[model samples]
Target: MKPAPFNYFAPESLKEAITLLERNHGTSKIIAGGQSLLPLMNMRLATPETLIDLRNIDGMKQIREVNGFLEIGAMVTHQRIMTSTLVQEKCPLLAEAAGHIAHRQVRNRGTIGGSVAHADPAAEFPTVVTALDADIKIEGPGGEHWLKPAEFFLGFMMTTLQPTDILTALRVPVSPPRCGWSVQELARKENFFAIAGAVCLLQLSQNRVVDVHLGIMGCSPAPLKPLQAEETIRGQELTDDLLAKVADLISEQVEPESDLHGTKAYRRAMAGVVTKRALKEAHHRASEGRQ
Candidate 1:
């Protein structure tokens, strides 16, 4: 099905886009790469009266390193993320995860911003950012502000963004030395959405955990960090038994809904499976000094 009739706009400037959004009074949607939104519009799941395109805005398509953090423009495509040498060297977790997104064409068109804004629980970027402790930048009538991943994402596809606010970019700290990260998912097929997924970041020194971050997706309304589980193993010796313990803690903490894709019990169980896999892989990578 085709989308409902709506005004289409390609704004050349961020200010212009914000103005158009404000003028529309909550009936407009800001579009970046059109990878996620177009599908929703096509299915009539979203019916915004005005579509304010951000693709024409040049400022939002950059990757810069500043003050120990990588400021990745929201418009950065998944394909680009997978290929960028800087991202590969400084934030290899993002590159690895980007490679798992839907096929080539979709990755070329799908954007970090659009995915984050869409807030799909199964999406890779959201869980990656959560584990990385990333921040989101936004601009609106009230001016600019930044929000941590936890503050930016609400349940499901919801966000704290006002209708007139434009999410401009994401900032992530550079991965530390001896850092090991892994993305594990239980997808029906390659490049498809996961029934349950887990991301793990581990920093190791002398075969012990220096720091660790764990984030899980596809098991809750929003991607979540099982903080208690992470803390349980943080600064502790890395062991198979410890990993299993952490995975069990995460499984007990996960809350998945029953859907056509998987049963709640099944997805919840898979969450622990992925977490254990992710933890093992990450630990191996850390041992090998790979990131």
Candidate 2:
């Protein structure tokens, strides 16, 4: 299959991009990295009358820290994040998650904003951003706006972005001291989509769980933060029984669909197992922080 005929535009500035999108209205699709959109277009799953490429737009490729938040431009690639010392310093969880995305080739071309905009339920960026409570920056004819990850990701391959909007950057809070994080995912192959995945951020104070965030992916319509599990673990010591209970609760909360790769029951079970492992690793890291 081949993509349908389309007009292509590579705007040099965000303002120009917005103007192009507004002029095209709903007939155009924004292309950054083209990792997801190109594949969809080739398969005839997506057919936009106009394709607006964002690569030529400057300033969108920057990564900086401001006011304790890491500001990552939309054009920043997964491989860049995986290797960035600043990302590793301020947002180690995001760095670890970026290392899990597909393969080296995909990571070399996949943009952070593209992954977030693509909003695959099992994608690493969405799960990590959701756990970190990151804010998405968008610009359109109407002006700029910010959205929480929950507001940005509507469902599988869906987002709240308007046709005329451009995602410019993401602002994520720096991981605080006493925080430990881990990303656990299960895929048949190293670079394949995960059947189930867990992103865990644990904060410990004097051997007691002070705060925790558990983001579950590959087992729901969108990344799920299991508040029940987080609440259950808070103020408690990291124990095997407690971890088991949290894992079971997370499994119950996820809404996995049965597919060729795995059944709903299988995904649910794997989600639990992954959640347990993530919690254990997170606890270990947190303990290391104390020592």
Candidate 3:
């Protein structure tokens, strides 16, 4: 189905885009890549009366480092993230996750901010960013502010953004030396949305886990970090038996709903499975002093 009639406004500056959004109020949609918003519009899932495009805005497509963090503009595409040396060096976990998002064509048009704002339960970026404790910046008529991933995501396909707000950038801290990260997912096809996924980051000291972050997707309303599971393995020597126990803890922590892609039970099971695999690989990389 075709999208309903809408007015298109492409602004050349961030301030202009913000003005348009404020003027349109509740009727406007801020579009970056249009990869997600276009599909939703075409399917009648979203029918905004006005579409405000941000592609022409300056400073919205940059990648830079600030205050010891990699600050990525909201307009950065998945393909850019996958290819950027800066992203690869500072946040390799993002590159690994970007490679798993749909296909090349989609990656070329899918913005990191778009995916995070879309907040799809099965999306990889949100899961990875949340696990990394990344910060999101937003601007509106009221001015600008920053939010942690948990504060930004409210529920499935929902965020804390206001009607006149635009996501400005994402700030991710560089991983420490010897830190290990892995992203694993189960999908029906090579590029389809994951049925279940896990992102794990670990720092091991003398074979004992010192710091760890765990995030799971496709098994909850939003990407979730099972604190119980993290605590289970943190500061402890990882073993098959221990991982199995942590897997069980993760399975019990998630609250997934049944759908055509997979049953709740299936998603829960796979969440644990992927988490175990991710943790194992992360442990290995940490042991090898690689990130």
Against the hidden reference, what TM-scores do the models get? 0.98, 0.97, 0.98
lDDT rank order: 2, 1, 3
Q: How close is candidate 2 to the true structure, as a TM-score?
A: 0.97
Model 2 Cα lDDT, one tens digit per residue, 21-121: 98999999999999999999999899999999998888989999999999999999999999999998887889999999988998999999999999999
Residue 117, candidate 2: alpha-carbon lDDT: 90
Model 2 pairs in collision: none
Task: Give the Å error, residue 102, model 1.
Answer: 1.1
- Which model scores highest in TM-score? 1
Candidate 3 C-alpha lDDT tens digits along 70-154: 8999999999999999888877888888999999999999999899988997898899888888999999888899999989888
Candidate 3 achieves a global lDDT of: 0.90
| Candidate 1 deviant stretches above 4 angstroms | none
RMSD of each: 0.9, 1.3, 1.0
Residue 133, model 3: lDDT of: 87
Off by over 4 Å in 3: none
Could you tally the backbone clashes for each prediction?
A: 0, 0, 0
